[model samples]
Target: MEKQKELVFITVIGQDRKGVVASISGYLYRKDVNIVDINQRIMTDGYFVMSMAVDAKAATVSMTEMSRELDQVGRELGMQVQIQHENVFRMMHRI
Candidate 1:
């Protein structure tokens, strides 16, 4: 059998507030996405930024579907959320 792998890079940015991490993480957990790495911090201007890498090997969700749901989460929290494939992210980040 061929191996199927789905990796995504998710970024959430906005003002600092409670439940930001919880809400996003909860959604990932509910979708059976294994979180590989998470980095969150508060900027000097007090804005919150979060970056997460998730493995969707066992998820029953597609990238577009996941993005749509996450968009709702972002709207609810007044944050700007971005979801992209790992390869595209890496390419953009690489030197």
Candidate 2:
């Protein structure tokens, strides 16, 4: 049987700006994280919001390290970035 993919959820929120997607995606690419799906938009208030589903089975680092590094990237972009396991995210958002 095939190994199951380790799914992760990534969320980004902040002011609208260039390079946010590029920078994040580039970093994931380098880390061997595959972005399975992504959705982003600029809200009426001009804030940028993005959510991504990623497969981290091939990632070079652990989730804790990835979160720390992504946090640094978010700080540089004046944004808040968060990562969580899919199950945890779902549980947190469940109605």
RMSD of each: 1.6, 1.8
Q: What residue pairs clash in candidate 1, if any at all?
A: none
Estimate every model's Cα lDDT from 0 to 1. Answer: 0.90, 0.92
Candidates in order, TM-scores: namely 0.88, 0.88
Expressed as tens digits, the lDDT of each residue in 1-79 for candidate 2 is 7659988989999988899999999999999999999999988888789999999998998899999999999999999
Clashing pairs in 2: none
Off by over 4 Å in 2: 44-46, 92-95
Candidate with maximal lDDT: 2
Q: After superposition, how far is residue 15 of candidate 1 from its true place, in Å?
A: 0.3
Q: Which runs of model 1 end up more than 4 angstroms from their true locations?
A: none
Angstrom error at residue 77, model 2: 0.6
Put down candidate 1 lDDT per residue, 1-95, tens digits, no spaces: 75477778899999989999899999999998889999999989888999999988777788889999999999999999999888986788896
